[model samples]
Target: MHNYTIAELVKGLQSKQFSSVELTQHFLARIRQFNDQYNAVITVTEDQALQVAQLADQRLATGSAPALCGVPLLHKDIFCTKGVRTSCGSKMLDNFIPPYNATVVENFEQTGAVMLGKTNMDEFAMGSSNETSFYGPVKNPWATDCVPGGSSGGSAAAVAGRLAPGATATDTGGSIRQPAALCGISGLKPTYGRVSRWGMIAFASSLDQAGPMARTAEDCALLLNCMASFDDKDSTCVDREVPDYSASLNKPVKGLRIGIPKEYFSEGLHPGTEAAVKKALTDLEAQGVELVEISLPNSDLSVPAYYVIAPAEASANLSRFDGVKYGYRCENPKDLQDMYCRTRSEGFGEEVQRRILIGTYCLSAGYYDAYYGKAQQVRQLIEQDFVKAFADVDLIVGPTCPSPAFKFGAKGDDPVAMYLEDIYTIATNLAGLPGMSVPCGMVEGKPVGLQIIGNYFDEARMLNLAHQFQQVTDWHTQAPEGIL
Candidate 1:
């Protein structure tokens, strides 16, 4: 059961090969057995999951169940799961249980997917590595000493470790895709506004978008079918018809032109990862995909621009967490001023504080024009670069991360090095385009991900390309040795 992909699990449940209760129990047991090795899950709702599974079994009997009925999945701690501690891997909100579910959680609930637990994340989704998580770092299943990418690292680890078949993760500058690359799984980041963001704890308001993480592209497509919808409550959500993402996943890839950016293959990329991406491209070419070399010259400026824009928004969004609010509050403060300063200083982790400080400074009146305004202009240049390249390409492909999973603390001392881990991924978010990561090959015993970026509202096409590639490769089928 643990080895089954989400597509297989759906079939088994529909055919009554196993009851949802039994399936839920199987996953709960797996989490208990394997989660300690990775620190992937922060909380387990064993009783709630079993109860939900029982209801799903009843619906299955009626033959009117939804696509995800009885499926068990994890939610990144950043999403508000009503009645569950929605800790964003920060001590500040450690005791906060959202009174209402995040729009993403509600959608999954409506589809009858049982929530087994909430996974850990970087404090307020602020770090590149899971080390900033208050719950502790998530160990890469491929190498226990290596760090799984973050702040979706726990969700990535949980799925990679086979504790769950899929999970819900958000990408604010590559959180979902980077971890998926390092942990060896399939993950997607839908176009901004394609998925509702209401109740999802804001990191960088403009860059944050939720999507699916699973073992196979087909599974991610199925999950996305349930996760996406237009909600009036989320002002950012686009009003568009929700397509069945799994419906077109078997589409032919011939005649499709994919762009390869010169910047992606430049210095700093690991040789093994480059070799793996090239091999994957060759395989795609054999399937008749036209590869075209293109230039995204502004790609070099993405890191600097993202750091400015993302932190600026984060500073404004996180201001609601002052001591007087619902989260952590300082005790026995001398005055209101003391309470405000002490509560924030003590509650937030070092990484979160660093980002907050940077954000505040960037948004300050004196530096606003030089930093934030200039970054916005650079962001526009990045978006224009993608727009120009897309004229001749159906999609853009590259290494999801510059390298495979690295030993914990390898880049901890250098913020710039850690920020560069997302070099190939941040542009898509800046451009509001859909992007996904699929395991391409192994590098030093760890996995490398091939990223596919598509035009806005073109997720079905992206998933189709990924599913077709998966049909020819076994990389996504492989799991960490000795971990299982």
Candidate 2:
């Protein structure tokens, strides 16, 4: 039951091969057995999950149940869950539990999906590695010593470890794709406004977008179908109609143009990663897909521009967490000023604080025009670059990260090296386009992800290509040793 994909689970439930309660129990038991090993789950709502499963079973008994009825999934901690700890992996909000469900959580509930628990994340969705998580870093299932990619790492790790079939995750900049690559799972970052952000905790509001993470593209597509919906509550949510993402999974692949950016294959990419991406491209080519060399001229400036823009937004968004509000207030402050200073400094992790400082500095009156304004201009240029490349290509393909999962603390001393880890993925967020990562190959036993970048609202096409590739290769099905 734990190993079954969401699609298979759906069928099994429909056929009454197992009740939702039974399936939920199997996953609950697995979480109990393996969570300590991976630190993937931060909370276990066994009692709540079982109770929900009973309701799902009742709905399943009816002929007209929701699409994901009886499916159990995890949520990244960044999303608010009513009556459950919605810590966002930071001590600041460790004691905070929301009274309302995030739109993503509400959507899953509407599908009759049982919530397993919340997964850890980098505090406030900052950091390229999960090391900044206040709950402690989520270890990569592939190699316990290796770091899973950041912010969304726990979601990716939980899915990869088979603790859940699928989970919700967000990407401010490559948080979903990078971890999915390192943890050997399929994760999607939908077009910025495709999903509602009403109850999701903000990081870089303009760049943050939530999507699904699972072992297969088929599962991801199914999850995405439930995850995306326009909500008026969120000002950033798009009003466009949400399509059935799984409907196009088997779409024909012949003659589809895939762009290979020269910058993605340039210096600093690990040799193993480049080889794996090339082989994946070749496999697609063999299936009649056309590979075209393209140039994203302004892509080179994406990292610098993103750092400036994201932090600037983050600074403004996180200001609400000051001691005057509900989260983590300092005790016995000499005054309100002392309280605000101590609360944030003590509540946020080092990485979160560092970004906040950088953001505050950039947004300061004297520096705003020089740093924030200039970065916004560069961001526009980067978006234009993608617009130009997509003119002749259906999608763009590249390595999700410069390398596979690195050993914990490998780049802790040098933040620039850590920041560059997301060099390949930040552009998608900057452009507010959809992107996904699917397991393509392995490097030194760690998985490599092949990133697919699609035009806005073109997620179905991206999933179709990913599904086609998976059908020809077993990479997406591969699990970490001892996981099963």
Candidate 3:
């Protein structure tokens, strides 16, 4: 029961294999048993979940079921849920109970899906490890001493730990893919504008995107279909047609042209991770897919460019949390200025402050053109690299992160090392393309991920390829030992 995927669970529900309440209880039981060890969940709405599950069962009895009706899923704390605490993993919003649901949350509710509760994340969606979460760091279920990557670490940990079949996560500078890679689960960051940002907390508005994290590519496709759509509230959302994402899962890769970027395989990548990616590519090749060497010369600058642009956008988006508006406010301020300073100082975590400082410096006068503007130009160049590479290939592949999950606190003090955790994934966000991480192999008994990147709005094909790879391998289905 615990090992069933989303699709399988949906089938079971439809066939009356188990009641929705019973299914919800199974996961809640698991969470009660193991979540304290991983700290993946911040809240558990068992009563609300059972109430919703009962309604879903009634809806199914009436033959008014949506594709994912009665299924249970978790929401990242970044998304606002009516009457539930939407913390964004910060003390600032720790007490915030939104009066309304986020567009994604609303959509899920419309489908009759049960909400398990909110999962923890980095403060203001900052940091590469879960340590920055105000609730506490998430332990990697595979190795208790290692870190679960962030800012969506809780989402990744929950799905990987089988606490939930899938969870919603947002990525701005690799928040989704990096953590999914480190945790050895499947995660997708849809193309910018592909998913609406109506209620998701902003962090680099131009780059932030919400998507799905699950154990398999096909499962991600189902969740992505429910999550992606145009919302009038988000002006940047593309008003394009939404497809039935699950329809493409069985597509063949007989003539698919795969790109092997030289820069991605060059230096900074762990040999074991590289070897695992290579083996996965070999498996694809055996399935009649063609591989071609492609070049992305400007890829190396992705990190520096992302740091400047993302922080600049983050600084702007985060400016709304003044003491007067909403969120944390200081006690008995001397004046308005003191109120602002105290609120921010006490609200934001260390990594968030670090980025704020970096953003403030780059966007400051005399440094704007030298830093921010230059970074924008490099961003365009990086996009051009993808354009040139895609012209000759159908998709690109690489190791999601440079290495597998690392020990907790190993890179906490070294900000640069932590920033480099997204080196391979940041380029996709910079280019505003869709990318996914699928379980490939394990290193030192920890799982590694193989990343598949696709052109803008080409998520269907990327997911198809991922589904094919998963069909032949069982890595995604494997779970941590001595649990469940």
Candidate 4:
């Protein structure tokens, strides 16, 4: 049951091979067995999960239930869950419980998917590795000593470890894809505004887009069908028709043109990762897909531009947590000013503070034009580069991370190196395009991911391409040993 993909699980539940309660219990037991090793989960709502599973079983008995009627999944702690502590992996909101569900959570609920728990993440979704998490870093399932990439590391680790078939994750920069690459799973980031951001804790509001992490592209497609919906509560959400993402998984990809950017293969990429991505491309070519070499010259400037723009947005979004209005407050404050200073100083983790300060500095009156305004101009160039490339190519392919998962603390002291970990992924976010990471091959026994970037609102097409590639390769099917 734990090993079954969401698609397979749905079939089993409908066939009466197992009850929803039985499936939910299997995952709950797995969480208890292995969660201590990775610290992947923050809170387990076992009682609520079982109750939902029981209701799903009742619905299943009637022979008329949703496709994901009983699937169990983990929600990244960044999402607000009604009655459940919605800690955004920060001490500030550690005790904060929302009275309502995030739109993503509500969508899953409507599909009758049981929420097993909330997964750990980088505090305020501000780090490239999960180490910045207030709950502690999430260890890679493949190699316990290595770090799982973040801020979606917990969700990636959970799916890769088979603790859950799928989990909700957000990608602000490379949060979803990098971790999925490191942990050997499939993760996707929908086009900005394609999914509602309402009730999701903001990191870099403009760059943050929630998607799914799962063991297979088909499972991700199934999850996306439920996750992507426009909501009135979120002004940024696009009021477009939500398509059936799973409907195109079996589409033919014989003549699809895939672009490989010259910039992605330049300096700072690891040799092993490059070899793996090349091999994946060769395999795709053999399957009748056409590979075209392209140039995204502005890609080199993505990291610098992202650092400026993301933090600027984060600085404004996080100001709402200044020791008042329902979060952690400092004790024995000297006065209002002292309370504000002390509460923030203590509540936020170091990484979160670092970003806030950088953000504040960039948005400051004197520096706004020189820093924030300039970065936005660079961001426009990055988006234009993608727009030009997509004119001749259906998709863009590259390595998800510069290298495989690194050991914990290897680059923790160097923030620039940490930021570069997202070098290949940040541009997609800057352009507001949909992207996905699928397991390509292994590097020194750790997995590498092949990133697929598509045009705006082309999530279904990207998922189709990933599904076709996955059908011929067994990389996405492999799992870390000893977990079971």
Candidate 5:
């Protein structure tokens, strides 16, 4: 029962094989039993979950429900959940109980998907490692000593640990894909406007995108189909139609062109991780998909460019939390300026503060063109690289992360070292392309992910490729010992 996939769970609930309350109880119990060790979930919504489960049972009885009806999934703390603490893993919003739900939350609620709880994440979604989270780092369940990639660390850990079948995650510079890779789960970062960002706390508006994290690509497709849509409130959201992601799951990949970027295979990629990813690519080739070596010359600049651009946008977007607004405020202050400084200094974590400072420096006069403006130009070059590559191939393939999950404090003191874990995933976000990390195989007893990057809005094709790969390989289903 605990190992059931989203598809199986939905079918089980509809067939009355288990009540929604029963399924929710199972997951909530799992959270209680295991989450304390990993610190995956920041808050569990038991009362709301049970209440929603009861409503789902009634809806199931009435034979009227959305596709994900009765499904249990965790919400990343970055998303605002009404009446639930949407902390974004920061002390600033730690006390923030939103009066309204994020669009993603509302979408799942309308579909009868029960929210199990809010999972932990890096503060303001700023760091590649989950250690930046004020609530504490989420441990990789595959190996308790290793770190779970972040800022979507908790979302990945929750799904990978089987605390939830699926969870929502937001990516800004590989937050979704990087963590999923390290945790051995499946995650997708759709095109920029694929999911509404209305109630999702901003961490880099241009790069931020809400996506699904699950154990399988088909499950991700099911959740994403329900999550993706156009929203008028988000001006950046395109007025494009959302396709049926699940419908493409069984699509054959025979004769499909898979591009292997030469730059991605360059030095700095751990040999074991590269070997596993290459083996996965070979497996795809043997299954009839064609593999072509391609190049994205500007790829190496992604990390540096992302640091400038993302932080600049984040600093601008984060200006709303000025203590006068709804977030955390100082207990006592002499004046307005004192209040602002004390509140922010106490509320923000080290990484968030570092980023805010960097952003402000870059966006300030004299440095704007040298830093932020140049980064945006480089961003265009990065986008063009993908456009050029996609012109010849159906999708691009690479190692999701350079290495498996590292020890908790392995890169703790070195921010740049931690940032490099996202070398491959960040380019896709910068280019505004859709990318996914699918469990491919393990390296050094820990999982290594194969990243599938698609052209903008080519998520359906990406899902098809991942689903086909997962169908043949058991990697997606392989859990850590005792997880089942």
Candidate 6:
């Protein structure tokens, strides 16, 4: 039951092979046994999960259950879960519980899915590695010493460890994909506005887009069916009709033009990762998917531009967490100003403060035009590069990260090196395009992800291609030793 995917679990529940309660308990027990090693889960929510499972069983028996009726999943902790502690891996929100659910959480409840727990992440979704999490870093299930990619590392680790079949995660510059790549799973980042962001606890408003992480593309498709919905509560949510994402899973991929960016195969990319990605491309080419060598002229500038834009947005979004509001407040402050300064300084982790300072500097009155304004302009050029590439290609393909999972503290001390971990993925967020990472192969026993980028609202097609690739490869099915 623990090894089964969401689609498989759904069928088993519908056939009465196992009750929802039984399935929920099976995963909960796994969490208790394995969580100490991985540090993937933040809160257990055992009582609440079993209660939800009981309701699902009742619905299943009455034949009124939705497609994913009895499925269990973990939220990224970035999403507010009403009474559940919605800590964004930061001490500031460690004791704060939201009174309302994030739109994604509400969507899962509507599908009758049981919430298992909340997963750890980079503090305020700021770090490239999960090391910055206030609860302690989430270790990679594959190699305990290696770091799971951030800020959705917890969700990716949980799914890879078989603690959950799928989990909800947000990607603002590869949080979902990088972790998925490192942990050997499937993760997606939908186009900005394709999924509602209300109650998601903003990291970088313009870059943050919620999606799913799971064992297979098929499972991700099933989860996405419940997650993608327009909500009036979120002004950024698009007013577009949601499609049956699973409907196109079996679609043929012959003659699909896949653009391989020349810039992606540069000096920075690890040879092992590059070799694995090329092998995956070879497999796709054999299936009649045309590979075209293309160039994203502005790709080199993505990292600098993203650091400016994302931090600027983050500075504004996180400003609400001052001691005056409900969050972590200083015990004793000499004055109002002292409270604000002490609260933020003590509550926020080092990485968060670093980003906030950078963001503040970028958005300062004197530097706004030279920094933030220019970065936005550079961002438009990056988007234009993608727009032009997509004219001749159906999708873009590349290594999700420049390298496979790195050892803990390998690049932690160097902020620039840490930021470059997301070099290949930040552009998609900047352009507001949908992207996904599928397990392709392993590099030094760590998994490499082949990133698939599609045009705006082309999630279905991207899933289709991923599903087709997965059908012929067994990479996605391979789990970490002792996981099963």
Instruction: Give me candidate 3's TM-score against the actual structure.
Output: 0.99
- Candidate 3 clashing pairs? none
Structural similarity to truth (TM-score) of each candidate? 0.99, 0.99, 0.99, 0.99, 0.99, 0.99
RMSD of 3: 0.9
Q: Scored by Cα lDDT, where does model 1 land?
A: 0.94
Q: Pick the candidate with the highest lDDT.
A: 6
lDDT (C-alpha, whole model) for all candidates: 0.94, 0.93, 0.92, 0.94, 0.92, 0.95
List where candidate 4 sits over 4 angstroms from the true fold: none
lDDT of 4 by residue, 196-312 (tens): 999999988889999999999999999989999889999999999999999999999999999999999988899999999999999999889999999999998999999999999
Instruction: Give the alpha carbon lDDT tens digit for every residue of 1-484 in model 1.
Output: 9899999999999999999999999999999998989999999999999999999999999998998999999999999988999989999999899999999999999989999999988889887789998888999899999998988999999999999999999999999999999999999999999899999999998999999999999999999999899999999999999998888988899999999999999999999999999999999999999999999999999999999999899989988888785889989999988988889999998888888899999999899999999999999999999989989899999999999999998998899899999999999999899999999999889999999999889999999999999999999999898644
Instruction: Score residue 472 of candidate 4 by CA lDDT.
Output: 92
- Residue 251's C-alpha lDDT in candidate 1? 86
- Distance from true location, Cα of 461 in model 3, Å: 0.3
Q: What's the CA error at residue 53 for candidate 6, in Å? A: 0.3
lDDT of 6: 0.95
Task: Please list all clashing residue pairs in model 4, or write none if there are none.
Answer: none
Least well predicted 10-residue stretch by lDDT in candidate 4 = 475-484
Where in model 2 is the C-alpha error above 4 Å? Answer: none
lDDT of 5 by residue, 215-320 (tens): 9999999999989989998999888999999998998899999999999998999999989998999889988999999999999899999999988998899888
lDDT of 4: 0.94
